[model samples]
Target: MDKIATVKWLDNLCLVGQTSSGHAVVMDGPPDIGGQNLGPRPMEMVLLGLGGCTAVDVIMMLQKSNQAVVDCHIEVSAERAETIPKVYTKIHVHYVVKGRELSEAKVARAVNLSSEKYCSVSKMLEQSAEVTHDFEIVELS
Candidate 1:
């Protein structure tokens, strides 16, 4: 994998990640110290990356099961220990799925499967953080 980052302006950074497929993702950083609204904070990017990874796992799993997944949202909250490392002690993930007559059992099962076996992000997080998951299903109006 190849990536690049070019300095744009004061306290601002533009980052890119290149995949083996010749695809790229551009990200940015801001001067957190001076409150420069240049780009997203690093910690925010970590959460977003984790969310994106798990989201793909959940959506693809539900789709493969023919669950008619119209929409799926996952909210993640992590408790960081107040120390130098500031490692996350616990993480709570709440998944809200929307579709036409979606199944609660299927949603729960999908989330379980992802956290337990499917989602690489969840598994990676499990090494250092206590990750938990819950879900709510909404039927189309």
Candidate 2:
């Protein structure tokens, strides 16, 4: 199935995006580019999408494996090229999983599966950037 989205310019390098799922997000450029900095930059939104996608995958995988998950957070960092059309050159995804007696093996497998097979955003970004992933498990008392 194909998804559709719309981005409408608001003002002064600012825009609003509506997702196919009916969610709305505001985007803006930096002050140097005449942007008011109302919301996140467009490239930042890409990282946000990647983080959200992987977070969902990992959490669901853990739950299906009968792991008692308390929280799951993803941190995404990237580097852009120096030249024009400054596309991302490197990207790293970090997963912090909090749970009760979570199996290390299962957590590792979940993270691996998301980056290597499940996460579509990661797969797409791999075309232009070197995407890497790692995870740490936090046991709940």
Candidate 3:
């Protein structure tokens, strides 16, 4: 299915993005670029999307497997090119899974599946950036 979104200029270097699904997000540039830094940059939103997409996939997969998941966090980091149209060169994703007696093997498998097959954002970014992932499981007392 095709998704639709619109970004409207709010003010100097600030814009508001609205999705067809009825979600909204604010974006802005740095002060040097005439922005107030009121919100995240557009590139930062890309990383956020990547992290959110994969986190959802991993959490859902774990829950489907009957794992007692309590919390899931995803950290995404990236490097951009030095030239104009600076696109991401490399991206790294880290997953921290918290639960009771979670199987290490299952957690690893879920992370792998999300990065390799399930996450659409990951697949799209990997076209131009080298995307890699790792995970750590935190056992609950």
Candidate 4:
């Protein structure tokens, strides 16, 4: 399937983007780069996209395995190259999964499947960055 997006400049280092699904997001650069902090930086959005993509896959997989997934949070940290056309050189994704009686094996499997096979964003970034992952499980009473 093909995806489409439209971006319109919103003056002074800011832009409004609309996805083919009609969802909209605002992107801007730093004040030094002429942004007024109106929204997230474009690079930040890439991190968010990776997190969102993997989180969805994990949650769905856990649900399918009958795991009680009450909450799921993903944190992504990245380092960008210090060169022209800066790009991500390294990325680490940490997942915090909360639920009652969560199985570690199942959770690990879910995470591995997403990072290794399911998440397109993660796979794409792997070409330019070293993507690594870890997870922590929080059991609820």
Better of 3 and 4 by lDDT: 4
Whole-structure CA lDDT of model 3: 0.97
At residue 30, candidate 4 shows an lDDT of 88
Using lDDT, rank the candidates from best to worst.
4, 3, 2, 1
Evaluated with lDDT, which candidate comes out highest? 4
List ranges where model 2 is wrong by over 4 Å: 1-3
| Residue 49 in model 1: lDDT | 65
Point out the worst 10-residue segment of candidate 2 by lDDT: 1-10
Each candidate: what lDDT? Answer: 0.74, 0.96, 0.97, 0.97
Q: What's each prediction's TM-score?
A: 0.78, 0.97, 0.97, 0.98
Please provide, for model 3 over 88-136, each residue's C-alpha lDDT reduced to its tens digit, 9 standing for 90 to 100.
Answer: 9999999999999999999999999999999999999999999999999
Q: Over 4 Å off in model 1, which ranges? A: 1-32
| Better structure of 1 and 3 per TM-score | 3
- Candidate 4 residue 103 Cα shift, in angstroms, is 0.3
User: Candidate 3, after superposition: displacement of residue 22 in Å?
Assistant: 0.8
lDDT of 2 at 87: 95
Q: What lDDT tens digits, residue by residue, belong to model 2 across residues 9-78? A: 9899999999899999999999998999999999999999999999999999999999999999999999
